[model samples]
Target: MSSLKKDVCNPYFSHIYIEKDVLKHPVTKKILSLFPNAQSLVINHYKDIFCRKNQNFSLQKQTPGLILARKHDNLVYEGAPVCQNFGNQHFYYTSSVMNCIYDCEYCYLKGMYPSANIVIFVNLEEIFKEVKGILARHPVYLCVSYDTDLLALEQVLGYTKEWIRFTAEHRDLTIEIRTKSANKKVLDEVRPDKNVVFAWTLSPEKITVDFEKHTPAFEERLSCIQAAVKKGFQVRLCFDPLIYCRDWKEQYRNMFQRVFSCIRADEIKDVSLGVFRIPQDYLKRMRKQAPASAVLQFPYENDKGVYHYHKDLTEEMISFSYELVRKKLPMEKIFLWEKTKEEK
Candidate 1:
């Protein structure tokens, strides 16, 4: 077992009654220390904590920490499209957990939420119940993880594993776990379910090296995805927030070519493409955090409250990426996020 697994065996986790006891776990302890005065609510599971109306800013700033535990009331439904949800498939995304492990400069979590702490909702049963309710209605396309990368913390949480098992039983519900993690230990323990699609967000090596601090290298992510494909996992590729850089065309083309060389085209389920964009308010917060970043410095056009690359450039990048990915994946497998006319 991994060191992360061993940490769970600690005595502090025995009493899940009081919120304070939940924080007694060394992982939770380290996180709670950041917010000494913040109250803890120990519920039956992770999904119980409601987002306090005004708490978004404060929560987004802390180094990721645990939040309230409760089961999800509903699952298997579509979410409004924001900066992250792509493919325009009317995605139904459930947050088995909140916050992320990686700290990318462009991440909206930095601007949208006030805290940087990770909130792990331990209530899997509730989410499952909600999902069951949805599956009863229609064939649901679910995004298992949008707020956090369950795969990255798989050993510690076991939520993704549970989700995989759940999806395996429900063939009518299509699930996607989007992640940037290179961790494949979970793959060793669980077989890939046909209904569970393993989607990875890929970027050029340069972008990973510069902007995506602490994230796995591009090659490492590709290697992990290839390993999953070999195990019969339905794998999908996402080249989103395509950062603008000098020689971006050459960089992206090479990246695409390299990906195809490593993973067979037939193994890939589909590709989703989107240019970099963020809510305007989030951009301001990110800029405050890191003023020196070229990503933060770029003059973005604002559509409503969201900021993005100028209309023409955003379209060009999206179009170019769509064509490039189409070279390896079929058109039906390629989904491009079109910018709204107002966004132009």
Candidate 2:
């Protein structure tokens, strides 16, 4: 392991809960070796701890524990309506890990999951089998880093490389791995694959520092994006969930100039834009956990079951970003998230 990996493996978890069935699994064993000092406890299933009622999600987030288990069913899911399909007919996502290491105040995981602790499924073959079954029918655009940032945890988990290798074998399978990680070591070690798209989420420096706790600074993430583009990787830029603030326009304007300055917009595969929105239930849970958070506490309008900024504000943000990106790339390459007429 590299010095950076060795250092990160030590501090994240003090206790690890392993499923009895996967205690002997290679992935589980390898993960255990990285944190020899952490106490290990065997459990029947991940949900025994992860789904427990009254788990202080906020408190556990401060120093979350780890759960290693085997996922037997529902390994892959149809992409949610809120997610951008990018014009793919058969879009799906799988979660090898659940809950994120970085705690963004606007993150829906806080409300979608009962616990803040991280869960890493040790069985990749099962997930691969499920994907293969789906691919047998038709082409697939799979988002591997759906629920978690796989590249950020690459040092400890090494699943990102495995997904890339798997994609290389299956011509019909195209995967998108989204991340805010600044870990350039991953890009350096892994070979680039055209079938695999590396999507980096970019936020203005002010919003990143204020709401995205424990994440790499904006400059660091920008540097990683540059490295990926230079290495022949299919890169996609995501400016989604555009947070609303008095100075949002200025921040996003400066961010666009800074990004296109370093990496040519034509070099990337595409760019995605969406305003910050969440399920109504999720916003309720998040508000409870972080009552003082301006991001969470804002009085957003309810459109059906989702909470979002008013329609006018949403349009202003997306349109502003679209025009800026249109200056650099053709209209075909820019994607915007809009509700269907039925949905509206």
Candidate 3:
């Protein structure tokens, strides 16, 4: 059952949905070449097929369709407040893809989008040009994988490799590709660049099994991080959206012990920690989309516009993580929401 689960768990892109206009484009052709067996469906626009009503996100994830489309406008967006800017003056994020392959119970994408399918913008060069123009004025920090996990889809998409080359040319440009994937081979393919940070999102094994569905387990994610770091990549570990599970303190404490034991503390760029949070409206929509989800059903406190663990729980989680991280890594290397309570 476990072996079979591994084979069936990963989302398979069995159908290719291509925008009619990009049918002749080289990227579309190359992507189609990768999946020659996938049935091709031509459409006028991606959202037309991707944003359809009554589509089951979970069901579609089993046999997901790939949408190759052209992004018309808003090539880049200012980074959201919820995300850590890492002290960048001009931070931005671009969604070359719409959705993720893995199905995490607490993921906001389920609420933010109407489809379970993955959308890849074939026009990668255009987004780069937009960044180049933005760079003409100021140094820019971009999070390219905010909307989707680029590492997980690297085999077919290879957008991260393209971004690596793009960053190589633009000295002023810095990008962060965040993922929960532990695909070691994909991580090794790209040349590690300080300008391009590979941030791994890590969770305790218990939370991983319960909240993060279809994801690489905690140990796998740690090994992936060690491999990247050994390969000379600036690795950032994110304990973000910290889950409040059974014996939460002990869970996180043991997880941290296992984490620093295998990976060198001094080599890590930084560690980010935060309690569970979702846009108030997104959580509302997620509850509607996944009514059975206990993670979303938790009665959270609304602070301004976002829904999150109440102040007390929020502080406890972040403070506990901060203390644990500081013990092994430098205090400066610790990054979090900066709860009112500080740990020494």
Better of 2 and 3 by TM-score: 2
- On residues 112-158, what C-alpha lDDT tens digit does candidate 3 reach at each position? 88888999999999999999999999999999999899988888888
lDDT value for candidate 1?
0.72
lDDT (tens digit, per residue) of candidate 2 on 158-253: 999999989989999999999999999988888888899999999999999988988999999999999999999999999987998889999999
**Model 1 lDDT per residue over 230-290, tens place:** 8898898988878998889999999988998998779888887888888888898778766
Question: What's the TM-score of each model vs. the native?
Answer: 0.80, 0.95, 0.93
- Native-structure RMSD, model 1: 6.9
Q: Which is the leading candidate under lDDT? A: 2
Better of 1 and 3 by TM-score: 3
Shift of residue 73 alpha carbon in model 3, Å: 1.3
Question: In candidate 2, which residue pairs clash?
Answer: none
Q: In model 3, which regions exceed 4 Å deviation?
A: 1-11, 338-344
Model 2 alpha-carbon drift over 4 Å, by segment? 1-11, 340-344
Model 3: weakest 10-residue lDDT segment is 1-10
Q: In candidate 2, residue 103 scores what lDDT?
A: 85
Quote the lDDT for 256 in model 3. Answer: 94
Ranking by TM-score: 2, 3, 1
Which ten-residue region of model 2 has the weakest summed lDDT?
A: 1-10
lDDT score, candidate 1, position 79: 77
